[model samples]
Target: MEGLEIGLNGNLVDAETQQEGGRFFAADASSSNYILLQCKDVLTLEQKEELKRLHVTLLSYPAYNTYYCRYEPTELDEIRALPYINYANIYRPEFVTEAGLKDKLENSDEGHQPPEEKRYEVYISLHEDHRNRLEQIRQKIIQVLGIDPELVNADAFILRAKLQSHEIARVAGIDEVQRIEEIPRLALSNNHARVDLNLEYIIGAANSRLVVGGGLGQIIAIADTGVDDQHEALRGRVRVIEGSRNTDARGHGTHVAASAIGSGNSLEFGPIQGTAPFATVLSHVIVDNAGNITWSPLMFQRAYNREYGARIHSNSYNVSHAGIFQQRQYDGLAQDCDRMAICLPQLVILFSAGNSAPFKNVTSDGEIESQAAAKNVITVGACESTRPMTRNPLTYDYYVAVPIPGYLALNLAGNRDQMALFSSRGPTKNTNGGPDDRRIKPDVVAPGTVIYSAKSSQLDLTLPNILPGAIEAGVPNDGRWSYMNGTSMSTPLVAGCCATIRGRIALQCHNLARIPSVLVKAILINGTKWMVGTNQDSQGFGRVNLAKSMVCFSNHLGCGFWPKQESDFARMQMIQGQELKIRVPLPTANPYPDGITPRFSLTVTMCYLDYPDQSGLVDHLSLKVLQKTRLPDGTFPERYGNKLPGEPADNRNNVQKVIWDGISAPAPFQHPDPFRIYVRVERLARDAQFLHHFALAWHVEEMSRGDAQFDFWNERMPSTDARNRFMRKD
Candidate 1:
């Protein structure tokens, strides 16, 4: 032997004895004797322990099957001689010698030893194969890392824990580990008037007792700080789940809940009813008393969907990080949300695009926050509420003066159609770590500036606000109602609208309680009217209009979608290299500007809840529409969803829309003209063999400049044999 080493216990060391931390080198050995060991496989716990006995310190396993180590020159042969070892090479230090390490250690407070490592709060995502064994894997981690039980979160799929930085590699070495990312801080990121949404027209047109058929029998869940169920506005409608507090200490949750389903309780707060006032709310308090989000969104989704039967989940919070102007990466938190959405196809999850506009430069585009960047959940942005700018002068002035160079301006928040200066915009980071692969976000915008909603009585009115003069602009001295501003307010409003869409579909389609979330999204997007004041990326398709969405469900409109087997309205399922075509009839009745002329426009939307992939490349479906008849120019017109008049099919989003604005098709007696449109859905990827389901919604109406109105009484429902054909191959 070149040299000999002994353990601290004074025994002659062998290659099999196990020890902890740094190993004892031979008395004459120095730090320069350190070497790197590359192995063919991950070391077993027993092997890791055995290496400590051979006077070798396993410093770290920085990469797969590789270890950085310090060892005695004599023990190098034994380590290299191991059957599993690939190579052992010297590890050189730039300038350090044994003297430097000794001097550094001797000056230490505890004498001759390195200081303790710092710990970090991290969110851990396990491999998909290990998802079902989450609890078992978590326990293994706890046992291996010696973690405190209190630091571990009770999540469904993803795991969150407090661990030292060095210990992270150990966890990554676990077979169940898929990705490791630093846990970014999460913060709250939302509403408007009923008139802006044209709710009155929708309610009156439906002739229902409440908005959007009163969102009958639908349950909307809200995950926020906490809700005060005792509040007069939300009193009888809010149900706080077990393990979640019902009291609103921070007050954010109460406002969010009320925005979604507060009954308005006219006896107390006049007519400030929520969008879907009749929908029941399942309140899940994810935030602590300090206003920090205590639970991951996946945890809330699991509880709300499985335990409470809430298919509509609204989230007002998203991950935040300093200097992170836009969430360019579809990080773990977003993946968690998307995973849940995929698992629960019936659940319509919504998240607020963050309120980080003031922090962005004029060149900034993808300012959407983490969880809000999820591909499945609908990300909502804020538009100026109809509320007069005078009511909140401070907020109005602040918006005009916000530091975003070319984006902020005076009177931006005064126009109901304008995008809010503080609302987050997006092309949701890039997917799979590529620059040109950005996805559009803020699927729709709603009123978020100076939105008036319920307030928590238990909250301290004296507390400071996050935004300048927010307390003065939002909270009143009485504390019964609040006038807040954020995408948070917008998100719940959309949630309520989603509930309304769900309820309306259930009533119209033979009580279809489990409407595919994609259908609801399709209906909602199909109804959106484009906003003139904002760019496409900033406002998405446009601000949501409930009246228009409900009109798509009206029997009069020549729109057809599925789950209505009675009317032959069925969704399409397809695999790779397959195409599904839906034929939609154009209303032939002369109910237009002229008694004998036909002038109409059509809108078609296709949506699907994509199957999640571990590689971040989700399933894609393309949508295209071709008119069966030639226009006056002697040419057949074709349109692709989200693309220009003749552009190629869109492959970037799960939802696609095509709008035919002004069409004066050939007469009813012309050749090849029953006046129908063929909508096609094509799958572009063959990554999986499972069948993918998609919903197609189409709307046709006579082009006229008039108030939002639809005569449903005289409307003709499509007959069972109305010749709407759906052709699909296996």
Candidate 2:
């Protein structure tokens, strides 16, 4: 309205229809009495005056924020809504980065005489057993810090205090004090993005008829800016955070939530839906009107506890850029949350690999960014789907198409299956205790091109790009749907993949109720189809194949579902230098009715939530696979702690992958009778949190074409067998 002119070819008509003056107004779907006029560009003074004359309120812009009007313009000091009783909470981030807040916090500490009247925010971790010393520590902390404390966790026995964080360490001599660390400035992660990542062909959502992969029994937590619960695509499915109003103001959170799991059943946008339509998304608006993600981790804990807890958390946001050298406070908080996840195996966090792009971060030459460095969480990057074509330049020539992900020979932008130029790459900044320790990052990549999903209706009221003359202007609006691109979009696809998998695992459909996060991570990586000419930095393992992952989890495609006679599950907590070994049978490949010789392999992957080492290092855990063969005495040589020469062994990463390949003339196959997984957790620094909790997943899979087996699922008695899920029916 600001820059629009009012003229109609000398016809002198009212500004109600057509390009002369009324080129924008689009009527609301439910009521023709309402009309929308979204200005293609910023408004001019005349357009503003015209909009005022029409009594229209400004809403969103190219920035994608949803603003109905200012609080004062409505003449209200506060939002009277039940949950959003306070209007100030609606503002965006005041500070998005830790460096900015660090200066302020440091400034608050230097050259100042403490005034008893002033209050500050601080975090304290107690060393004593929480069950018995919780109250004791609370009273002692209050007495020493001389300020009130907000209890954060009873198990970890953590607290946020009004006392300055630096002062807490000074008072640690006052008993019950273990360690005191300053809390970082919390801000919402900026994931502002992919559609095929959510599409059925890639992830098997529609292929399964929406029964298993459509997120039937899974729940996801979207901790971001805000979600517009009233949006047609998410109406019945959204439950806003308790204290926040059920609406989106920045529009980022809304876009993210809908893309990850929107139902898309609403009349306005039924043609498109989220990767996990049946999944529940709980919104936690950590970013305020100031546009920062700097809220307390306490808020996340509360949301995590909601409705029996969410199985997966999709975070399109982060604490800082990847160059941050393993942030102490933030990384600690992430690890603490991961510890909670191990206790509840289904709880896993998925983070965007980041959008830093072709250029590496200053702190790290690798693309790995801040929150994406966490050990337990799944970090995802952006990969675009592309098709190749060739044509003669000087002569008349017909274009020939090349298939994608595999077909494209060289990495090129605007081409399919290639790693997105914008996705953060990785050789993560040293997470291990030493400067030399670097781990492969961005565990996987997914589609992150121009992805179309539900748009925020509450946001588009002003910019009706889809109505009337605006369509000719080539706006990217489709009424209730919008297109976005980034790692943010790709991450949700992975989260939805987890949801779909868990739905089949936990909903009485499979023999096993759950699988360890590490196992799932390993299976997903194992199942991925590698991109052409990609490395550990650009694409960790490869693109996740939803059908393959599902096939593996169900004990098909040569996988052994845990808790079976040959498969097993265990949750372990080990101390520094301690080793835990789990052994599962190794099956030999045999010929089937098809008369094709098959090969076999075993995979053992162990995963755990790693906290900053007492020395503040990140990586300190390892998993090893050792072959155990029966000797002439009919006893396994490695069974009695005896080491045999020529034994096959691999002690790789915390995410260990061991395989026994076939077709070598020397052995033909390397299938050991029983495979032993030795997980050694090393603590270089004594101050390290000694108890390392972990989950182990062991499976025996056929490396080649093998005989078919009976379906494992028995409606009467569940079994971790694959016959019921994926074999040609008899």
Candidate 3:
């Protein structure tokens, strides 16, 4: 016991408990013992085994050198007496609250319950390994707090319960509880979207039999208020996975659902086509009639549901006040989404970056909060539409214009090149509670201003906070089609694009399982047309273009999932310094029109689902394309993902891209050189046992005639509708 220090505390200590000298003292042994144990060094396997032998269970080590321990109160002193221990203090839930809240709770009137609205409904996350003990902990909390039994809902890793201000601290003191977060009431956010995204061109190509299908035989899952499955455009293809289609009274979800896969005509407009007009939609109604929403896990429940067969999930809603607790809260929806991604590696999840741009208190002009800040999710933002608004010509400008004092507003969403005023921006705020972290958010943007799509028949179009005489619905009297705007419109459109790509892969690769989510993500991002003047924080990797993305895939080397030798993709476990190389052949020179100077660009993208951690990224790999031949200057030409040659490698993001463009037509014809793709792991999660997995996709393009080449490639490629495991059997 040379360097050991021990103190005592139990589950029922109230505000009156003294906080002197790193101790809270002990009470009765009615509940399990939870001690915040800290040590100078990380505990060894033998040391951990010794504690287990003493009947003490180590819960989790979130940050610092501290470990959460559960044991009988009698064994506290005995464990503290062990040689490796430093300080074993009582776990104080009150310490988690902000300084202001601590003061308010500590100095408040006794027997006082916070206001109804202030009594937050929160999800208490338990230690990952303690999931089986969730019910036991919840029952203990119910017995101790005497709360109504109906208010709690338990899952594999979380317990959802409504708690008053004082009860938050008491719940945190539970032995198995890891963290708590207030459930956010998500708001709807969506589109001249089809034209802006070049969906019309892709659809036309597919009709000509130039491509496999425009998202044909694919499924996209939308988790929103609800979808109007009976709507003319979405009637046959839309299936309700959670809530009924008739429940969409807000019209937001119906409009969003249509933006992705709607296939019929609008009442006013001739044809209201979605990005993926042929793709099926699975609707998960997350919002209730009273406008309340479930916690994060329930919001994305269907991503892994085999019956839904939805590999792509598009959510157009986000927390009302975005970024307020983003940096401070590590156990919020963002963490939940990250954990979900780890569990379901093939699921592609997209979230709206929120419509909180006008409020400085919400955005702080930089971070997007909650699920939008999740590392594994593709956070989407809004860009102005190129086509004119149908109902009100300048509605985009009117809603986004500077508002009267005390209200949130900004002037940014009019021009096609500019970002929408209400679209949240990002250089995501790191989790301040743990390690330093930051990543570029709003992964991509699409035209989201004054978009027309299917509207719920039962929806009441009237909403608040509008200009005195402005119209609420874009189409004044049309019952079937309505126009709306926001990242919500853009998100589903992107999801449709993902479905299109994934669908094509499923059809093209006859022998594989579902195309890896990372492969599709890489291909979509790799083909992006970078907005020359804008930075990554606002526009991400630029707009999603189907024409450009289709051309990004190799014409010769096939891209397929794992276990298929015909596929160009590779998925392997990598450790620090472990490097894998792939040789991506460029398209052979093709005869072009006389005056055109043909240019070729080789783009490579790699993505991996990393282990979840406090520091946004748990695993990182660097992508670089190396040329075989050395230049006359004795330096071999190389391009790092998103970086110029000779710069240091990027360590920030999980998705990486390297584009080697502008090679003269003669070089490929003369040399036929293949870009040497190198993927190397830089680091792994703390608990990761030496290895992590990743997927890599590469393509070579003839930039001078990209569309012509896209059509040509599709015409030559074999076409079939090979549905994967996620396809609905019912």
Candidate 4:
């Protein structure tokens, strides 16, 4: 009465005993025996019947495997049953025999390796089940061949052939950089100008004799629509890193790279140069034929890690899908990608905020989504200029597609305060209660509306069909020099600015990481002008004023208003019976270098009305030191209120305290030579509302020395100035 066991597909079963322990059998009787068979390729009918005759129960048979299996199982009783198998219902079978399994594992790299190799070890990315099976097959191979698996690893390694020369040539020529050609007056039209980028601004900001980006030997990686190396503006500056089959497929990348560092000049039919002008470009194409940026950040990581001396990477594409952060796969990849991006010692990654403007809600996925959301990368947004118009009013034909008066001639006036409605708005907030962390989309906003830059000759002319009126207006619309607008246009502006700052810092300090924080502070404070009614959400810190920033840098005056101690100070103070208490406000700004110390001067003007009884007790004032306190061990002590070397002591007489009488009659002061003490006023009536006004001025040597920046003000001012003005009473 021994229990019988069976095996199928190498699954062991004992006919004498039902216990689990037994020698491996090729077939089993129980329905569970089907689990042992690997369900990969199809099985034959003969194999199925052979399996059935061996008393093995078949759970499923793949169409292709049906030819390998023999004799299908049928009922033994007096009952007729048709085989419950159909083409659609058939399932693939796994390798049953040891030799079959070994063959399956060994053939994994069949087509991947070169033909010269006798044997190849393939690195296969497989599911857990397949990996386990492969591991078992490896052990069996070692046992049968009497060789160590480690020693066999070398013989098993696969060898792949290098890319063909033609393929390399094709990729190299994909986005061949071209020289910019000057368009004649006949070609000059309104449609062409709309796409014209402000190359002047880019060049002007980068014109610094003290700093040149030419010999830094830093490589800037561009992931976009591939570059036009043949463009005159970009001629010798661009170097292709990775070119896809669909090279020259798009002009976005070329335009972006040129805007950042084009070396040609537009006036002489020369190159329409960029901001850097001499920085080498390492181009990598990421966009596809569908006009979509489908490549993930992993591709960027691969590109970055492949080379040793690469630093900066720029991408002008944005994602449309918003749920990337919610998915585990995307989030993990994003974090890893960000780490990879910032891993380089001097690495700086830049991304376009997106073009989904006026809408203000939509965003993209992968790099676009990750860059905007990633803390390490710089995300750029677009802003339009509203300064008084300086250019002449040129008459041009208007577009019929535009809702405005069509077919009418209009002056090209630049005095405007409007921003493009299509430029994307960020500080991305996800409504879906997922990990909706608020990302400050654009760290800085640059001029992106109707920018002019170099383009490729191969660009499809049909693209203008999207906006026929824009094309016919002759607004610098040539395929080489286009006037496209969007945050995509704005991103390179900031990236160029970053390059300029980095170059300058490298010349002076030899550190690149210092540039990000320094530039962030400068742009946030000195370079930014506060626009009325705007908050931090929309406009952030306002427009980037390079002139003002340079001025601040030279003057050493820290940008932005320093926070006064009064803002955080409490009013009441305790006084001891035996001693008088004196309080002084501390200076909020950091001190300059030792020899060039900041000079702080305070002037107080006091007016007093003569009273008959108090005439003889005229207001008296004197300055004196109360007590000097040491800073705590772990804390950075306040510097302003600290007592100087020499000073008089606080007096008990109420009428002898420090005082100011006015311009005509000044009050006496103590200890004026070596050092002055805190000024105080006495003899004031208890009910009096004493006017205590003082002006504190200090000189700052360099704005770049310390952090003097604030977040940008959003553009959301109240409808009326009176309602939003800080000084207004109403």
Best by TM-score: 3
| Alpha carbon lDDT at 259, candidate 2 | 73
Candidate 4 lDDT by residue in tens digits, 1-730: 2222222222232332221333333233222212223222223345345445555454222111121121133322111111322111111122222122234334545576543333322212111122235444444434544544563221111111122222222221211100001100100011111112222222122223423453244456777767778887778767776445323545677777777776555542344545556677777776655454544444555555646334567777654533222211112223333444433324567777665442222344212243454434566666653322222442233222234343234443332123333444544433121123233344556666555677665565454323222233235524457655566766665566556545555554433233332232332223433334443344443454433333322212221211123331121121111112233233233222234322222211111121111102112223343222323665321212212323342221111112211111011111112122333443332112222211111111111212322111111212233212312110
Model 3 lDDT at residue 278:
89
* Model 4 ranges off by over 4 Å: 1-217, 243-247, 267-272, 302-308, 321-337, 359-370, 385-418, 430-437, 462-474, 477-479, 511-526, 531-533, 547-730
Q: What's the TM-score of every candidate structure? A: 0.75, 0.61, 0.78, 0.44
* Candidate 3 local lDDT, 320-356, one digit each (tens): 6433333323345777787777666667888888766
Q: Give the C-alpha lDDT of model 2.
A: 0.49
Whole-model lDDT, model 1: 0.63
Model 2 scores worst on lDDT over the 10 consecutive residues at 391-400
TM-score of 4: 0.44
lDDT of 2 at 440: 60
**What are the per-residue Cα lDDT tens digits for candidate 2 across 1-730?**
2222221111111223422224332222122211223233334445444444544443211011111221212212212121311111111111111232335455664446554334445445543233257566677666665554553333353665555434533454443343444555543322112233323433222225423557775778887767888876688887776776666655666767877787655343345566677888888877656565554435545656745367677888654433433433223455455444544555667888876643322344575644676556788887874412121121101000224232233233544457766677775653321123345678888876455556665553342211111121113435665545567767887877777766755653355544455545655555455577766678876787655555445423234433322134333444456767665533243323244344544444455555332212332456665555556787643311111234443222345444443422112224523466676655322222334445554444444434422222212222223222433211
Q: Model 3 off-target regions past 4 Å?
A: 1-118, 202-212, 242-245, 322-331, 359-365, 390-402, 405-414, 433-436, 461-470, 476-479, 553-571, 587-599, 631-635, 664-673, 686-693, 702-730
Whole-model Cα lDDT of every candidate shown, in order: 0.63, 0.49, 0.63, 0.37
